[model samples]
Structures are given as structure tokens and as C-alpha cells.
Target: ARPDVILPESSLLNLDGVQDAKLHPSLGGFQSLYDEGELAIVQNVGYPEQNFSHFRSTDIWMTGADTNELLATGWLGRYLNNQYPNYPAAYPNEDVPDPLAIELGYNLSVAFQGPVSGMGMVVGDPEWFYRLVNNIDAPVPDTQAGDKLRYVRLVTKQSQVYGEVIKNAASKITQQGGYPDTELGEQLKIVARLIAGGLQTRLYMVSLHGFDTHDSQVLNSDHTKGEHANLLATLGDAVRAFRSDLKGLQIEDRVVGATVSEFGRRIISNASLGTDHGAAAPMFIFGKHVEGGILGKNPVIPETPDVEDNLGWEYDFRSVYASLLSGWFCTDSSTLQETINKPHEILPIINPSVCGTTSSYENLYAAESWVRNYPNPVTDVTTIEFKGTGKPIRIDVINAQGQIVETIIRAKVGAGTHQITWDASRLTSGMYYLNYHNGAIHQSNALMKH
Candidate 1:
């Protein structure tokens, strides 16, 4: 039997608060993008019965397969497979000169793993790729694994060809403003330059890591702030700055950006004050051509769950991909249906008219919350343990008749688990409510006075 690894049975606090803000304060940069209609927010997104492991879940996402199935060809790879038939031999011709896809900050992902061979390249940096490809001159292979070596050689050969072209394009443009000096910002900065310099690359993938916040997610007694805050800030700043840079270069209309994660943390916080992997999180889509708005409602967080399935299941992730393919890239529904092995409904996330008869995509990044007050049946005084946003939060104590008894808390709170002592020595013994209200989040905890 799995014991309660997080909260005790007497869990209390009041974090279900009204949320009016699109993002947390730490993510202010992203908020600006949303205001400009450059962000489309899709909340509560996940596959049905989502897998929790990082590797398996990422594989499922990349290859567009269910947890029980495995696909050698990636969803994107299948798309490219159709784009360039007889790919390896027919590619590098006049019609297909540049690489079809480019990935930054990692090796080739399964997203580009084609049926025969992967149909993409991974360049950590344009300049570095230039030097590496230019310097390499491997002699003809004399090994028995001739076919495999030849494939390897072909990848290298293409890398060399792309290296010079990418390098030249990168040199022609520079990022304009507001980019954080962080890894995500740097990688996105490279993407902006390459795009501005006239690289007709259809698919480019960049990454930001460290979303696996299993323990110490927030500071002790201050659940509002911690490692997750910094990560969210980095994301906000990177995307905002990248968009600004693109607009400055007058190419903002040509690109769209989507932010996705493999899974969301469970509603219940673990004993270490962090969350376990769960299903149905949010996805962010940003671009000038986006039909900016919230695609669906936020995932409903339950008070207590007997099973992981208690977490709400919402828009499957494949729907987002289908919309992007059919509406954004103008790919037909039949092709996407065949490639993904599912007839995922189009989400209407992209602006159809932006790219001249293309098909149609909100940014909401608020922190998750928890609360617990011990000694519920107290005689005189009681203590409330509240998990809140990193910014200032307002806690109100109300009597049974829906009148404010007292304003218990109103201040900027740090990250992690927090506690507040509430003295109800003056009020008559009766039922009451403890309410927590941040800018957009609103929640209440019922209190029994003895």
C-alpha cells in the first residue's frame, strides 16, 4: 500500500484564490507578450492516463504514440518524410538545400526520427558548428559496418553543408533587446538570428530544462518562492525578449512559439513540500499570428485524491500538434491523422489569415498552491499553514454569515511551506471560513469554532 507521502490527513490552509493575472510576477515579461495578443494559453492539457517517467513520456510525445505503443518514426519526422520523399538520396538537391529541421541545446530528438533515418540536424551553436564541420575531414571508412558508417558520414556531410550557411546567416543579424543572460535566452537568441538571416528552416526546436521539481520546490515555510520561480522567470524573460528581438527585425509575423511540458505535478504536495508527477497541465503558444486567448479552462485541483486519475483529464496534447500542422503549416487533416494515428481535433490556436490562408492558437503561468491548518477543533487559538504565490497574498477570515471577521494575512510571502497563527479567542464558538486571495487565485478553508 502507498502511504501518504505528502500531507497528513488533517490537511488545511486556503490557497484556492481568484486569479486575474495571466502569469506570476516572476513571469512579468511573458505577461507583456500576452497583452499584445502574441500568446495563446491552453490549460489542463495532457494525454489520457499519462505516463510519469520522463524518458517514456517524452518518447510518447515525440513519436506521437500511446504509453503501450512504440513508433520508430516521429510525428514531425513523418511530416518531413512526406515533404521530402526518397529523402536521403534526393535531399541536398536544388529543391531541398537547407536542412528541414534544426534542434538547439540537445542531440537529435525522436521528434525528427524518420522511418529510415532521422531527418534533421542538431547544432549547439552556429559558430561552433561552423568550426567543427569545417575542421572534420574523415577518411573513407574501412570497417565492416559500411552501411551504418555511410549513414553516419552522410549526417556529418550534411552538417558541414548547413554549418557554413547557418554561420553566414547568424553573422548578418543580432538580437535587439530584453533577453535574459540565461541559457534559454541564449538559444532563442540564436534562433532569432538564423531566422532573420533568411534561413528557410521549417521546424526549429529549442529547449529549457529543470521542470522536474520533486523536492524543495519552494523555500521552507515560504512555499511561494524557490527554484521554480527562477525557472519561470527565465522562461518569461526569454520568450518576451525573443519576441521583441523578432519584432525589431521585422520578422515577427513569420514564426510561432509553443511551450510544452511532459506532465504536470500532482495536486497534493509531498512531505518535502514539493509535488509528484500528475496529468493535465498547461501549454503556451506565442506568436504574432496567434489567435490569443485561453483555449480551455484550468485543470480542476481536487481537495484530496484516492488515485492519480482523480486529477482532471483535459485537451490531449496531440490536438495542439494537429492544429499547428493543419492550421499553422497548412497540412491537411488526413496527413496529420495518418502520421499521429489519431484523429485529434483541431484546436483553432493559429490565426488563419496571418500567413495567407493558413489555419488557426494564451499564456497562463500561475504557481500551484496548498494549505493546511492544524488542530481544527481548537478551543481558543488555531494556526493556519498556507501555501501561496511568491508575491504578496491576502488572507481573510470570515464568519458564518459571510462577513469578514478579520484580515489575517496581507503581505509578500517567500517560497515554500508557510504557517500563520490565528487567534480566535474573541469570536463566539461557531462555523467560519478562511479565504486566501491572490491577484487571480482564490480558495477557502472552512473552519469549525468550538
Candidate 2:
């Protein structure tokens, strides 16, 4: 699920004991670098039951009725398309560009793609982006046909210049201070720079790869270090550094970061001393807006051996997404339903009983609401209940920002007290919310599990 702040490949680090391990590569010396006040060790956000087979093909993940319908345009894409309907397309070539003479970039990713004239900017080297903007007037070099070799040289030079421009844009990105040298760190640095530069970007997207750790994952004499551990260390350092950088700039309140992957590694270590393909993985969110604690009920890591070689899921991944759409973005529940395309309200819009009350209603706290899992997180069964006037009601689970996760109820009932249990043995772990509504009243509450 998408949130203001996300760490797609976050690690569960021991922030307190890392100071003395500064020289250790495997540990990454996190405690030595960050203050306890700044670090939070969150567990159970990953998909314990991840299925690797499903990740090999985008179609498998994107075409499934349950998965595809939940994520039609991606969280960022939908937000941008809806926020700025007039923003230029990601791609609008001259020959292929519409008669309207619109200029566009290449493929559109909902995170960086927006309809607002200047609501977002692709994070690149500062000098390069500026060069592209200024070089719009630069003329293409011309050479006589008899001197074909000269023309080839010119083209090569131009290409090099273009490459340089891109690099410079990425390098020249300037913020007040604090940026890690890692790839994802650099990208985030650029994001902070853009925000400081008044780019007005409301949604940002960045990624870190190398999480497919399938071999040699232990720190033994025979095995140097696990691929998974190293990757996790980098992730921890980069994210911590990014958070520091954002705080230094005083823009932490205005921005959030979240991370996702196609899927997660298998729970059971493989014969090769590494994990294999699995279903459901963890996702992380970071920011002042985040509820800085673990969410979701932890899935049971089965001790009983099985051929599947993976842990089970406690909550559906879609529930996390649904929370983002409805909660953080402040989008209408109905509109979100159309985008997600699942039946039943995935998120609760208004507290059904509180809707008519005069008592001051507080905005849901991002951290507090998400910090605790209710009925405990479940792997096989989850109970959904509603209390109020006897009426037909529907219940839905949404993620932090209000994207629907799953519809728990849809039928009418002579409602005095009603409860439904979800067979979520096949879902992932993350924060989710339950929305309950009758034709006349609406309500929402947070749900969490590992």
C-alpha cells in the first residue's frame, strides 16, 4: 500500500545495539549513526507468505481479478490523474504528439506522473534537468553528406551531452544538507531538493532493488554474508539517512515515503542457503504522519514442515492500499471504490454513530491508529463486527491513506450486533481499516495484523 512516507525495502534493524558494531558490514552500524529518538524498529509489515511464482510475471499479479481490480492505476497514478487532470502526459512525442502540440516524457508512473501543470518533477540530476529545460532552444548540429563521418561524430557528441545533462540534473539537486550516497538515497535526495525548490510535487516514487536474496544468506565461515542481510543493512542506512536529511530541511511534515516490491522471499530457507519465491511481503511507511510503530498481526511461521516453503499471510495487501487512498489522500470512499473495483466498502468513510454526534471528532492519528492490530492479526480467520441500529450493513478494510483492502460484508441484516470472519489465510501483513455502513450511516475503524 502507498502512504506519504514509504520504505519499499525496509529492514528490521536493532537500532539500539548498532553503535558498537560500527565496523561490521553486516550490521551497518545503525545505532552509531542515529539517535534513539529518531529510530523505530517495526516488525510484521512484510508479507510473510510471499509467493515467488506470482512475481515472475507482471500479468500474474496484474491480471488476477482480486489483485488487478484492487490496483488499477497504482496509488500514485490515481492520485495524480485525479489531482491534476490537466498535467501533461508522460509521453507526447512530436510526430506522435497530439495536434495540440503537447510535450511529454516517456512512460507514466502514477507516483511521478501528474496532471497538475507543475505538481511534480521527475527526480534527476539538477544540472541535467535544468540543461534540458534550457536546451530546448539548442539547434541540432548539421553536416554535409560528403562528410558522413563528421555527422556521426556530431551525433555521438550530442548523445554524450544528453547523458551528461541527465547526470548533472541528478548531481546538482541541492537541498540544505544530509543525503546518503546510495542509489535510492540519491534519488530521495533529489526528491527533497525538488520539494525545497518549490516543485509542488505531492506524490513521489523511488525504488531500491536487490531484495531477491536467494543464496548464501548466513554469516558463517563458509558463507561471507547473506544477500538478504546486506541489502537490509543498506536499506536501513539509506532510509535513516533520508529521514535525517528531510528533518534537516524542515520538510518532513510535508512529505512521506513508502516502499513496495512485486513480492517477498520465501519464509523457509532453501537448500542453497537462501529463500525462494513466496507470497505476500512487507511494506514500510515513514514520515511525521506515520504511526511510528508496527501494524498488522504477525503471521505464524509454521514449524510443521510443508512443501510450500513459505509463511502464511495475515492481511491482504489491498487493505493497505485502501487505507492510503481513503485516509491520507482524503478521497471520497465511493470514488476510491470505483478505482479499486472490489465489492463492499474497503474503508469506512464516517463513523456511523459519530456522524450525527456533536462531540468534537478528531482526525485519525496516523501512528496511533496504525500502531495496534485488533482481534490480533489473523492468518486463517478474522472477525468483522458492527454495532448500531438494526439495519443492513457493509464492512470494508482499507489501508493508511484509505485504499480498500477487502470487503468483509455486503448483505443487509437486522443489525443489533453483527460479526463476520474473513478467511485471510491467503493475505499479506500490513495496516488495514474496517468501514461499516448502512444506507444512511457510515463509519470506519483501523485494523492491523502481522
Candidate 3:
């Protein structure tokens, strides 16, 4: 939804013949990290049959279920369950004295709920957990329920071992300063401290809310000085500080952070100066070991846009998960299939050098299509000519940075030669790719606009 951060060269003048486009200026930290090769942008990340409902979409993302499927267990929960089958019954042993996953908040996300019991623990802090366990002073009834209550209290008290472990680890090192005072910053600071303190936790989850910007997304007087901008600034600053803290702790390469949203905003703004729920948005992944560069093509802003028009996705969100499982965690194909329930193409998000040996994989990104844009160096306009199979066809203008600057066409055409006029007068002078795709056939033709 933040085009300035993803597609910095996209022009509103070209789409609507009105306002000019520019970077939001609130994303300086992200820009700096990207320029320094610590961040990679994944474009048009979504799943098929995108349901716009926030609750449903969030469930789909958390549980890693298909749009029409219902899943009770989360993706990571399934993985952890598979990895540690003796969990809950035989945890906190000599080899596993710490929580497998930790969520730095009060309520644990559904993502950590295992098929049987929760695969992780959630706490605001070490003291918080201790106080919760100690504050249970209610009297129990003299019946079968009393026996159940006693057992539950005993189990709760036994879990306090985790609290002691967390306290010991956190006391090992004071956090390296530079984290923003924001909530996300504090949460990430705790994560860094825990990891640095020798906690064997493999997964940590933290969250930042208020992204449901239905109104007042931007200021009328200044488009970049409102709710969305403030959130972005918070995110950018907190993440930058977290990265610095990780580097200072010498754990930069051991951790990777990524952002996920339920859905993206529409391409068009409403009367309240905010965008509505839409499909397909960009995702950001950052770490020292990440292959820092843009992945997949940029989203295509359509010509003659309408309120109903939303960005189409290129890479599925499952693909990103698959990459992490394969590239970062080095999980086997059986694990991948069990986690995501399907095979998805693995992107080069993680550095291959770090992952010395990996299972054989496939690329599901695109196929070859026969298409060409005439007039190599067009100063004003160019003609995109291609043959389609009477199916749905899409043509996008992709810049060198892999951002889709403009969409030339997206429609069904007859099986014959078709030519569409693309006005590139408003586009910057640079090398671009005219990408055409119709189902299994996809291709990109180089176009130079002077």
C-alpha cells in the first residue's frame, strides 16, 4: 500500500493526469537499510481467492490454510509439533530447558497454538509471569472440581520454571541501547536480549497494531504527515534500532525479521482520503544473511483505474514461508509439505553461502511468453504487441528495480496479434521491462524510455 517505499518511481500524473508522485520521506530508515543491503522487498505477496475480510484473511495467514480451508493449528505450531513430538509431556529437560517459542505479549497468537497444547509461552516479562503464578489465591471447592482445580494450579506453578529461566537469561546482559521507546521497539529489545542471553528459543513473535487505516490515512494538507506515515516511521526507526542492537550483540546473522499485513489497501483513495481493503501487498525481510535486493516484479498500477481495481499478486505468501523453512531452517521436504500443505517456489531471500547444502527445489515464478514492445527508445509512447490465447492477459511496465511502474493492459483477448498503446511520456528516462503474461506463458521485453 505504501507505493513510495516499494515503487518509488510510480507516477500519479501518468495514471490520473493530476498529482505528481514522490517518496513518503518517512521511510528513510528502510531506504538506508535497503541501500546498505540489509533489506529485501517482496512484491505482490498474497494467496489465491483473496478474501477481503480481515478476520478470515488473518486466520488464513496465521494457520497457513487455503482460502476455502479451515485449519485449527497454525503453520509454525504444526512445525514445532512435528519437530518436538514429546512436548508438554517431556519438556524442560536437560537439552530443552527453555521455551521453544516465545511471544513478547500477554495473549499468545494462534500461530503458536499446537495441535494438542500450545507449543510456546507468552509473557509480558519475567516478573509478569512470576506475579501471575503467585497471585492465584482463590479458594477451591470441596468436590471433584476441587481436585481438577488443584491439579491445574499445580501445573501452572510448575510452569514457573520457565519464568526462572527467562529471568536468568535476561539478567545475563543489559540491552544495548538505541531501541526506540515505542512498543514495538521495546518488544524487539526484549527479543534481542533473550537471544543474546542464551535462550534456546527458536521462534519469537511480536506485533504492532493500528494498520486498519480506513480513514485519516494521510493528512489533507500534507499527504505524508498522518497516521500511516507515523506508523511507518515507528516501524522504520524501531527496526533500524533493533538491527543495530543485533549487530552490537553479534547476533545479526542469527535472526531474520519479516513484516506481514492481513491485506493491502486499494489503489484508489476514498472521500475520507484513505484507501479501502484490497488484495496483494509488498512484504519486507531484513537480516545480515538476507540476499538484499527486490524479489519478484513490482505491482502494476492500472491505466483508467477504478475504485474496484486492486493489485494482483505475483508470489504467494506460502512461497516466502517455504523459503524460510528450506533456506534458513534447512527443513526437509516432508517438513515443508506438512507445514504449508503444498509446494511453493522458494525465493532467494536467504544467502546461499550460509545454506551450504539444500534439498532440490523448483521455481514457480513465471514461464516464457512471446511478446515485444516496438520503438526501443521511446521518448513519448510505445506499442506493446503480443499474441494471446484468448485468455486473460496482463502487461506491466517494470522498472530496473523490479517495481511495476504502470500496467498497460489486463484483459481477455482473442487468439491473434494485438497491439496496445502505452504512453511513457510521464515515465522517467531509464531501462524498463515490458512484462507480458497469459496463464503459463510469461515474458519480459526490455524497453528504454528516453
Candidate 4:
């Protein structure tokens, strides 16, 4: 089934911006991804008590913090560090062959910040990345702005860590053909090639801009032939080309792409046929393993909206972040919660083939993975063992729905064998996920509470 794209009502004919626009069907590229069951539309997703300021909203999204609180580290960066502790330090090792995450394009994002330091590598293209890596000067400027960017500039130069590997990968893979000549297409093409060459990077960050359509959103006569239309078409074209390239490269299953913005435009158009900053917009999630569906029904268009009127949030954007961490990356509930610093529901977005227990992703874990729980269905108590990296170890009992049922331990534990006895007699009899966090690494197993 194709996506349902509600076209903007004809700009000239629109008496009030609140009138429901005629359906134009969903974008072609997205429609294809949807029909193939490789896309999920999370509608009306954003933070609560919205702020219209682009910088503030962007900061909120990047840090995954509450609109009121300020957090410096990025959620994705924390997750990657969880998988490979002491990143950029333990990195470039034979066990870990590539940078854990790569940020494409020039958009300096806060989404990849890790504690102590940001853990991802920044690159433009294969050639440009090499040039920057080779010619890096380490002395950071002495200023507030310099201190803020000091970490990013430092990590950007760490290309030496994965430079050879990336170069080798780019040399081996050849893109199939027909990518739009747009900036987004160029970035995605590089990403696809690197993944095909086996970079083993856990996360790839890229973005598309030009969505801040205030004026000339749509043509006066044709609802779909203006600035906004052109942006959508460019995005659709880029996505289609990238999808085809991934298919040709045979690495489509290993990667997933998502779109994010600080805030969406208002529900109503102004006299200039443009929308003001609004709240609760739609986000697109695409991957070979995604379960495609319209997250919910079309957003109920409130009749008679105002400048302040906007779509009510259905799912918090952090919920989608949680989904990517746990469902796609198989991050345990405890680490995932810790990374976001907020409890958010992990959606059933990915197909069971990749998200279920006994999935192939389990093979990616370290050999010294935590021991399994004993007394399969614990009537009174269950015992488990784990090896810590001399860091804080957090053991949590997570219910089937991915909620933390109990906190068995939360203090720092030493290396070697540490046994834990979980008292689950009081809990209801059902399956649960036992999440263990040893330093930056996380491991989980299924436990039955009987």
C-alpha cells in the first residue's frame, strides 16, 4: 500500500489554513519503502510543552533532555559508547575495526556526544575525510565557543583511527548509478558505500535541510509546485536513489535512516501561503527490517487553529530514539534508559526477524558476555553471573514490555565473577528481560518469572 500524502490545500483558494487539504498520496520514494514493509511513519512526535525557538527545540531533540533541563551529551553517542566502552581509546583495535559512528555532511550535531568526550567521527566525503584527517592541527582556540567545539575538532582529527579502513572500504565498493545530484544524495551514497565495505560503524548520522518553509511553501495556484514541493521532491528522489544503491550493494539490511527536525510548521498557512513554526510533525523511519505502517491515523486536524494552535503530540520523539536503540541496535533496557536519562517506550518498529531473541545480532556481542539466568522459571529466586570491566555494573529486571520491574544492583562492582540473586517471588509469573550494564557494554537475556 502506498503512503497517504495529504497535499497542501491550493494556496490561493485557501480561505483559512485550517481547511483539510486534498490528498496527493504519499511521496513516491516513501510509498515504495512503505509498500515493501520497510518504513514506519511516526506521526505527531515531539516534546511536550513545545518551544518554538529553533535552537532550543533542536537542543532538546539532540540531547533528549526535557525542555526545562539542559543535557550536553547526545543520546546516540551514549549508546555507541555503551557498545564499545572508552571509544576512540579502545577504538582502531582489531576487535573493533572502525569508528563506532560517523557523522556525514557539515552539519555539526550534538546527537553524537559521549561522556568525557564525543565518540563519533565527522567526515564529509571519502576524499575530503582523508584530507582533513591527514592535515589536522591539534591546538584548539582559547575561547568559550572554542571550548564547546574543542571536542568535535579533536574527534574529527581522529580519522587516523579508521582512516585506513574507510579508505580501503571506499576503494572496494562501487555505487550502482542514478543518485540525485543533491547534497543529501551525495552524503547517503558515501554512507552506503562505506557500509558495504564493512565499516562496522553502529550509527550513521546525516540530515536534509530546507524544511523551514515560512513563505512560498506552495504555489498560489498549484498546491504542490513551490519551494516546499521542491524540497519534498528532492528528498523523495534522494531516498529512492539511496534505497536502490543499498539494494545493489546488498547492505540494505544493515542500515536504517531516520529524519528529524527541531519543530514542524504551524497547522495554518498565513497570507503569504506559508506556515509558521509549529509543533508535533511526522518523522520517517526506513530500513530493510522496518515494519511499515501509518503509526496512527491522520492527525486530527483541529478546526479553526491559530498562530499558537498546533498538532498535539502523539509520541514523544525520544520514544523513537528508544526504539532505534533497543529494537534496531538491541540495546538492553537498562543502558537504553540510562542513555536517554528518561524512560521512553520502545516501539515495535522492526520486524521480528531482527528484533526477536536468538536473532543474528547476538553474534555481535563480546565473547565474555554475561552469564544466563539459572532456574529457568524462578519460583523464588534466580542466580546470574557477570564479568565487569572494573566499572559500574547495573542489573535490572525488565518486564516483557521493556519496563524496569526491579533494580537488583546499582553500585560499582569489581572485575571477575560477581553473583546476583534476584528475588522475583513477589512478581507475577511471566517472561522478563534481564538487563546488565558493565561499564559501556550491555548484555541482556530472557528470564521467566514463575
Q: What is the C-alpha lDDT of each candidate?
A: 0.70, 0.46, 0.76, 0.69
Q: lDDT tens digits, residues 1-450, model 3?
A: 343222224321121111332234677677777767888888778765678899999999888888889999988998998888867898889988999999878877787778888899887643454354355445689899998997897787676668778777877876486877788888888888888999989999888888788788877776756788899888988899889889899988899888988888887777776778888788899999887877666556644445666676767788788888788888888888888887677778888767687545534434434578778778998787888778888888766444568888899999888887878899876556676766534455667777
Kindly list the per-residue Cα lDDT of model 2 for residues 150-191, writing each as its tens digit: 566458547532233334433545445665567666656666
lDDT (C-alpha) at residue 146 in model 3: 97
Ranking by lDDT: 3, 1, 4, 2
Question: TM-score, each model?
Answer: 0.69, 0.57, 0.74, 0.69
Tens digit of lDDT per residue, candidate 1, span 144-252?
6866786786787675666766767766765456678887887888788788988878899989888788777776754446767778888988998899899899999
Tell me model 1's lDDT, rounded to 2 decimals: 0.70
Model 2: which ten-residue window has the lowest total lDDT?
Answer: 95-104
Q: Is 1 or 4 the stronger prediction by lDDT?
A: 1
Residue 329 lDDT in candidate 1: 78
| Predicted candidate 4 versus true structure: per-residue lDDT over 1-450, tens digit per residue | 001222544422221122432223326666667667777877767665677888998989998988779888888777777877886675678787787788886644788888867777778654575454355444667998878687786665563566777777777765465788888788888888788887778778877778887777777776657777788777877888898888888877788888889988766677776787887788888888887766633554433434545565646688788777777777776787788786554556767667565322222334345757788767887787766667777777755333566888888877777887767788876556566755434445566666
Lowest-sum lDDT 10-residue window in model 3: 11-20
Q: Name the top lDDT candidate.
A: 3
- Model 4 is weakest, by summed lDDT over 10 consecutive residues, at 14-23
Q: How accurate is candidate 3 locally (lDDT)?
A: 0.76
Clashes of 2: 81
